[model samples]
Target chain A: MSRTTVVAALAAGVLLVAGCSSDEPAPAPSSSGGAATADAGQDHDYTVEGFASSVLGDGTLDDLEDVGSASGEIEGGQVEAQIVSVVADAAGTELVVVLRGDDTGSPSRWSESRGVFTDVRGVEVVDEAAGWRLQPYTILDVSGESDLGCACSEFPYRLGEDGTVVQALLPPLTEGTTSVTVALPGLEPVPGVAVTWR
Target chain B: MQTRPRRTPRWPVALLAAAALTLPTAPAHAAAAPEPGSTVDVAGVDVPVHGTFSLRAAGNASRDLVRGAVHGVRRVEGGTAVYLSLGLPASASRSLPLSSIFTRSRDYESSALAAVTLVDRPGMTAYVPLRGGDAAPYSSDVSEFRALKPGELVVLWAVFPELPAGTRTVDVLVGDARAAVTGVPVEDGALEPVADDLVPQAGEGWPKIAEGDALAGAEAPWSVRPLVQHRGSVDEVTDVAETAEEVDATLAADVLFDKSSATLTAASQDAIARLAADIAARGTGEVRVVGHTDSDGSDSSNQTLSEQRAAAVVAALQPASGTAVTFVAEGRGESEPVAPNTSPENMQLNRRVTVSYQVQEATR
Candidate 1:
């Protein structure tokens, strides 16, 4: 376990024992179902392995709702971007993570394959420090389409808690720039959840 | 002590009577309220799970005090709910699963208490930790208590905050535990309007009002004022409010009928009814009923037929009680047909009425 996980576990254990008497009867098993797998320090990449359900600590991630965006190209089709926002529900138990990004391309073409397609699936965080804050990372990773005998034709991917990431894979673009927005509804209950960029 | 007054002796009798009533009225035993700052341990986490719940006062605008223990918290995105549990044998900690229940009352504020219970058996007697307090109305309180049952797991409920009407964004939090933030677009009860005043007639395209293009084209004889666009059509321009030039209320219908047939078919009537109702409710723009026919018929015959048809429709629409009805009957025999008479389908297209809309003369 990383230092953060160890610290969180110790802190949680101490708080739990503080209020109870030493001789109090041991707590019975709870009827509520199962425990979540620990998600400490696990930054989600658009890769298939990064999309599993994991437990998040308190104050780690911020809840995001109703994410949407429009695509814009800058830096000669090398960089792309989208803007997003969400509402706040105090009783929520998880943070909603949304991703929307586009690849740079020609202005006249309406299709995305004719240009680079930078999306939330193409960018991934490589390394980070102990307290790296997370911004909305629209683009997750980027891959060159030239390897597949297709110029500018590339697929973009994103992560969803609903296990829809695999089924909802994006296809290679046709031309210009393509914008993809991942909207996750519902509540998030974690604390201090952050995203890192490589 | 010494007897000071003889008149005070009457007070002793009154005290005896009051004691008799007050003694019986008191509760058998007052239940003590739980102390503040309690903690619940579950899975590898400690939750400060106790707090006072209450609704605010009235006259300060809102009411509906909601307070109570609800079902457990579930990760909607991840599809998991957590229940806190502690074991006596220090090394044997386990995570419990739980669901959620939500409740609210009409009043803006009220108080409720919830207890967390851990059972030895799935459905047997369990350990319960109770917390009680007042809550605001319409607020949903979720927690980890459930109706007792053999197979039932953990349950929790929460008094969630208010949501806005249309697509809304909200962050769901537990004290400070952010379960998740989702951008949910609350569905407004309002019916979204489909494209309106669509003039689909051939020959005359929609008019060009400023930077926007209407159904004024060479193919469609009748012009349409596009209201709302769904999935984006050719003539529909989003955000046309700023640059589009407004046009005068001319003939606004998707169709023009043949002379003197007051018979509006079932298909044609549906479109006309929608247009008529839209105009009547929106503004003072009245429907102008014009009738035309193919050159196969005589002038006098066509003229009368056109007049009869226009009148029939005007009668059909009996505009909302006070709406003005404008029926103009002009017969142009075979003058304009949307499509060429080469195919039967093209001929049928010409044998119809056009519907369109313009700003009500009064509103502009």
Candidate 2:
């Protein structure tokens, strides 16, 4: 076969597979799409369109996967937090949470003292049943793909496609604690997000 | 609507050319001149270096003028210590304030001297000479603001931990004064002199032999407090605050734009150029330019102004060639402040722009 014929056939095969992948979620559309198609008289909630799928969950410290999610809001923008990963080391167990801000342009703010992450008032994991309130411990050590190109902060975090992913290192969950909660100061508390390892 | 012509398959030919291009190009060596002002000639002594601070001419009377020269660099335990001989020329007829040279408190972020970055790493810990040992100063103390008399040369040391091995040279910046110095061979953790001809003249009150004696010990007498540590390998060049995830940088808005205007000043453009180079060197990434303002203006006005300013910075920061990096502009107005806006100094701190980068790790 001619080279062009082979190239065309391969391209067609790839497109066929992409079109047939119904199980996979489609990529989010660009925010600029609405602006290009809008009429002068029409009003649009850019916030909702831009950031409605806001979700946050826990995952391993070294990976980005949805373990659980929590309700979060900043200003008028709704936030979703997913636990990206949980990493266990000599120090403690680190719960990596990915915080997404839909509609809020560049959700996280930068501080010289505090690295880049959202400027929410407070973030903590609560075990109300055990009467234990765990503060988020910032990860001082960063390397390889986990390093944020700026100065190192206590928390290991990276800016995502729609928001920020932060890691909180806390003491290992003790026995007898049935559930743990994740809290953002202004948003509604998300309870029972912790998973049972046993 | 226009119909596009079908393209021919050119990948076979391109792939062959790419394979040929990937052949070993050249060994890594220090570029003879990587900076515009790479050479400094003071008192007829020529030293090959790079910096923004000019040793060629006297600085303006209003600003404290500082000049630096790298004497030697040696590997110490846990870090690399760079011995710098700084001078405030007496001929300038003005005393250079010490506050501009080094901070007295541990809070390096607020120090004017914080601008001096160790180019090899993200951030550097600065030390000043004291009796029997070195003291790491912070920005919080007022007593640190001693003046530098003319013709007086003070030797200071900056230590950076875990510098990538095989790093033969590194750049040091003190305010605008920048120097790229070659590392000297170390014997017993002490720097051994290279060729005698390579040594630059140590000006009056600064004996060349005495300079090496100041840093003779294997360890500094006082415990060295590292402001920024390199947890990664030396090959990685990132911001002092940067980790594997992101890079954050703050540009004072007052230094960049005119009051209420989105236009960039010449100095701000230069600063942005440097920032762009740093971002580009990271290989590939996305840069989000965020604009912030103090609580002086109305909410709506502040928001609009902040957005416009951010857009202006983004425009300047974009690479001239391929789109390996994406730029996003955002404005927070008066919503976020690093400091309280009540005081003038604090308000000055509030008016700023932040550049954050989400870098993609290079597949090695």
Candidate 3:
């Protein structure tokens, strides 16, 4: 098959289809099923949203991957980040993913001139057919101030359907939680990256 | 793993090809370059030699390979000449190659001499080869040994190429330095060969063995006790066991006195003090002191001089008195010797006394 289809197929194969296919028609107008339907419908209303934050790339997450460029979204108090470049520490215990903003109104680049933040507790890993699945929590640590300290210890996170972290080692965050941040040794205007949660 | 019987080294296909054709025979010869280092073999390694080594047995050797070298080795067959190569630095002696013996003018003629001495057998030869599988016959003559200078290293290899061979040991002596190597005979000759049996690899075990210790966790009896327990005192056994309570304190010392003199030398003082301490520690034991002399003087004078030496020691011990003492002095002049009578040290052992303790019985 084509490379695009293969990559997509690999990604989909990891979803782990567990339920059997149904053949019978749905029942009409069941009074007892109404309450359950309402709850199920409410769970689907989850709109990709999260708080915006950045962290040091000191192994606060597992299963971190590199995206093409750093452009992400912040929705529903949750940050959805698309990280491009990744930097691993000398000891292989921490990883840093460069974050960027890709919304039509603004484009972002991997630079040190800007601020980046993320929640240290959001990193998780999930093992799926498509290698490992990484799920991060909401960007709960974004303080808006540009002086986010050194990028020596924060990292960007990759999200999965089920919040599971996949990186081998994660460093404790400033608040004694897991977090990571990626920095290009001497670059300014550090790009803006966001995080999303399940 | 199944152990297959040892056999001759599997010669390369090319070597076997050469072996098939009959070659001319000649007396064994060494190569142009002699072994240049100490020779040693690891234990249980099977080494073999054919080709040139084989030709030596046929009595048609072309050139002498081990020209001038000292050797110490044991060979499988009889009649091989064994020689020890000397005159080189210890290191070079061990490495002098057997091949160094061949003369250029002679075009490497095989010499019948063995490097080390061995009992003569009609057609037996020991062919030694390097780890790289080169063989040279042992040489037998002191003149053939290559002279060694300072700071040279030589490695000599002992060749043993036969099957059903027992473990053979050889001490390779290079001047004063020595090393050892063992050889295992591999095979008789290349005939019907058995393949080695394959065994399970390490880390993989049968489940039965993994179960381990059929009687593990079986009941066992064990006990522990404190260092001291307060039990009522039991009856004592006759206060103390009947044993020797006294020790000998009188010791005879002989000092090399100036001719016909009674004066004791400074060396005699320490020996006399040790005797005094022993006597002071003995509760009330009698001391019998004796002395002897070397066969250097007339019998009567030696005896008199010995008595005087014993008296000197007694005089020194009398000052340290903690026990009653009885001094019985005797002299034996050159009557008995402990070592060779020729050395001064042997004479010293002869001129001494042994003390014995005589504890008196309790007075009823």
As for DockQ, the candidate ahead, 2 or 3, is: 2
Root-mean-square deviation (CA) per prediction: 28.8, 27.9, 38.3
- Our model 1 lands, by Cα RMSD against the true structure, at 28.8
By TM-score, the better pick of 1 and 3 is 1
Which of the predicted structures, 1 or 2, would earn the higher TM-score when compared with the native? Answer: 2
Using TM-score as the measure, the top candidate is 2
Q: Judging by lDDT, tell me the better candidate of 1 and 3.
A: 3
lDDT of 1 by residue, B1-364 (tens): 1111111112321222233223332211111111122222222122222222211111010211112111122221111122221111111122221121122222222322122212111011111112222222111122323222221112222222112122132211221111111222222121111112221111111111111021111111011111111111111110111001122121212233323355655545544454456456543444455554444466677556656665665566555413543444344444666556666655554444332334443442
TM-score of chain B of 1: 0.28
Residue runs of model 1 more than 4 Å from their true location after superposition: A1-198, B1-279, B294-308, B318-321, B324-333, B359-364
Worst 10 residues of 3 chain B by lDDT: B224-233
Ranking by TM-score: 2, 1, 3
The C-alpha stretches of model 2 lying farther than 4 A from their native spots are A1-198, B1-52, B55-64, B107-116, B121-147, B152-154, B166-169, B175-243, B247-364
Candidate 2 residue B29 Cα shift, in angstroms, is 35
Choose 1 or 3, whichever is better by DockQ: 1
Candidates 1 and 2, the one with greater lDDT: 2
Give per-residue CA lDDT, model 3, range A84-182, as digits (tens). 222222111222232222223222222222223322222222212212222221111122212211212222222322221111122111222122233
Interface Cα RMSD in Å, per prediction? 28.3, 24.3, 41.8
- What is the descending lDDT order? 2, 3, 1
Cα error, residue B295 of model 2, in Å, equals 16
Error of 2 at B38 (Å): 10
